[model samples]
Target: MDDYTWRIKMHQRRRRVRRERFAVLMLVVLSICGAIWYFGLYARTPEYAAKKLEQALEEKDIETFRKYAALELVLSDAYDDLTVDLFHNDTSLTPQAKSLFEKFYVLIKPQLVGATEDVICKRVSGGMWVMPEGGDMLKGRQLGIDYEEFLERSLLRSTRIKSLGEVTKENGSASIILEVLEENSHTPFTLELGMEKNDEGDWQVVSIKNYRTYLETVSPRIHQEVTEYVQATAGIVAKYNEILQSKQWDATYMSYSATGQLTKEQRTGLANYLENSVIPIVKKRQEELNQIPVPRGAMYLSNLRKESTDLSIRVWQHYVHGLRDDNIAEFNTAESLLKQMLATEQRIEDIIHRAAVSKAIPNMP
Candidate 1:
């Protein structure tokens, strides 16, 4: 072969190799670009956001949860829906009364919304509700509501997303329907979340589209649960009252206090009466009360009753020691404990009366 022909063939072979290398490089670049678009942009859709939100809630990933949820905006809209349902749809409320309530709600809406947001944030973060620094204690007392206790009873605290149903997107906005189950009631309900794409092209849940519907669906179950709780509590309270009334507890104590002083023989008799009679009865009642299962709604009352019973046991023990060892200070301590026990009893009665009169629970004694 001639030297010129060999050089021409070599040039053509090198040209072909260069072209193939360029094509392969371009293909690699396009593949990387496609992946960037899919994962970094297209993957951040409304449905993706909703799924992330569901996972965040399930895992209690507060930061990730907040990333997908516009908590303040969503809760604010939900509060409005709640008020509309409460005021507009109550058939028993006079139009004038409803107007008054609506006006009052508007005045307090900001504070209520802020408080609820705080509660939800704490709950999502797996933290207990603590009154914020510089909170208004006087106003809280006047409201006669325990926000923490209210949160404990609320459906929000127990809700779990069962499934993501459907997603509808329109003009940079979207709605996702979620099927949720509340652990407390074991009732499944649907929630529609309104979402919007921000300037960054990420979707965030901004509102609850059907909060009123959700409330209406859950309200009957809530009422039934409350009624059942009240009935069970009333039965327990009645049993406690019966135990207190069945014996002449006051008479037993009166015998010791009849005279300011007692002979040694009289003291011995009184000590025996307290130890063998009064103490056994009080201890038995306390044991029974301890064994009773307390419902969530009646926890405060149950605790108070338990405290009163404990004080009763202490009072009798002190009385017995005061008589046996002739210690006047023990007698004084018994008297103080008795006063505390009576005060606790009064508080329990006051709570029951308030609950009964408020029609919070019918047929409650």
Candidate 2:
């Protein structure tokens, strides 16, 4: 080969060598990724199984959970936590997990499998509730058992789980989403859970991440009892307004429910609740409203009515009768009366807010 030919041949050889190096590099990267996806993602350690078991526990899905848990974990913790719940007569658990599970079963299990399950199912298909671990989220550390009460109240409260789909797993750690339907607000709230396994091979929930759960209210057809309440409450409030204006104390007292009627025993409690709870707060809010000049325009009556309707629906949700019934007749009566009172409360609050806004703008019709 001549000098030119030699240069050209050398260039070609260099290009081929570079290409081969690049190919090898790509192969290495792909192999590493495949390993992570397989062992880290698909492989199940006792920890991963335990986490799934915990999710099953929160869901109260005993049958499905039974399959996910290890035999030892099931015999030890699972048995106690699921079978002997207050509502469940499974009788297959030790008294401790069973007794503790009772509180959870009474409060949350129904939402997972019973009638409430339908409501949740409609919200998220293949619906599963992922609860956030409670504590400092940065390190994903859990609170100690001694602080159980504080953990329960504080961890569950003030959490901000927006959607259940945000949960994912990394390494051996699983990120969970805690979904809860608030009774008073009638809204679905979510929070993130960070969990890991302890030395004992038992899974411990660590912390709640991004704790920013906010109010999410929805509008739908309410129960019939709630509708009845809206009408009855409006009527009762109209009557009460007339009674207050006409100074019919006796008749007003008679119209009040037993709790509100100021029975000899209840008078003190009512006075304390009204004085300490309602008036001071409303008056303070009114004072604040007085300082801030009302806006030039008022929210339309239709808009106000819509807001009131939504609020009424939310308040009335508490009257929902669940799976257990001591007596159907009693449930119906209590539910009806409760819904009516809630509707009245909604209407009264609506009127109060509108009145305040109206007074802010004297020309508002």
Candidate 3:
């Protein structure tokens, strides 16, 4: 081929290669955009959630409104110290009444996980998820700060959102400024609704900055209460753990009040362990194990289970007297043997018949 012809062919090939690379680049960009859209990242942004929340409240769409609210995060726990002091220790009640209250306080502390904020949210949501069935005493009472009041000040029907700033995003978290005005209020408060990317990689509202300004609108005492409530939520779970640890497990078990108070701390099977009377039986077995010459951390049935079945049985017979825990706590020996008997009834009957060749078949247990 001539030199000019060869140059022309080379130029055509280079142009073709450039076009192919550009096509691949465009395809990659489109794929990324599609994935972002598919994950609903656009729909789950803080700005989008805020706007939807505002509209939901305005339209009285309680169901939709709940999706945007952090019910778990804001709610008080019935088991909190403040609540125990308030409802469980009233001075004027009769003895029977006080006893009943005490029983209820003990019963529901762990059972009723969410408290005032959850209660109010449920009411607002028309019982989308109600409180603990026996939480009548907490009715109509806001534990510390009324989340409703916060909503009223921050996002109520009469509240006007003055501005929504561009979302400030960091790695997997974001915040956006909002200026809002409450009904008949001259001051427009500035706040920031913070957001986080959930496990599903969707943005969710996690915090509201300077939102405590709403608490300031109330009385000083009310402000203090709200502040305390917020602070309590931050550390209350750990506080509960501490309180539980502070309890003398040995005394509670020995006094036969562990179940009436709380289930055995280290229960494996849920049902067998939670019953009121059964915990004492389990504790008695544990007490027997405690009397043994075993070293630290070797008292419980869990450690026993890790040993060979023969070892477990030997240890139980040596340390524990009645083997009640072998049946109820560690594993249900009676139930399992009965099941095995039923499963091998034919074989068992045949063996019995052979054994009874010299005597009549024994009556079935």
- Candidate of highest lDDT: 1
Query: For residues 45-134, what per-residue lDDT tens digits would candidate 3 score against the true structure?
Result: 766766766676566676667676554442322133323333322334667976676576566543233454555556565634353344
> In candidate 3, which residue ranges exceed 4 Å CA deviation?
1-40, 75-135, 140-165, 184-186, 217-365
Give one digit per residue, the lDDT tens place, for model 2 in 201-309.
4444454443322211111111122233334345544653564344335434433665543354344443344344433433443343334322211212223334434
lDDT sort, best first: 1, 3, 2
- Among these predictions, the greatest TM-score belongs to 1
Displacement of residue 147 (Cα, Å) in model 1 is 1.8
TM-score to native of every candidate shown = 0.61, 0.27, 0.32
Candidate 3 global TM-score: 0.32
Please report, in order, the local distance difference test score of every candidate based on alpha carbons: 0.71, 0.40, 0.45
Clash count in backbone of candidate 3: 0
Model 2, runs deviating above 4 Å? 1-4, 7-15, 21-25, 28-113, 126-365
lDDT of 1 by residue, 304-346 (tens): 7778888998998998999899999999999999987876777
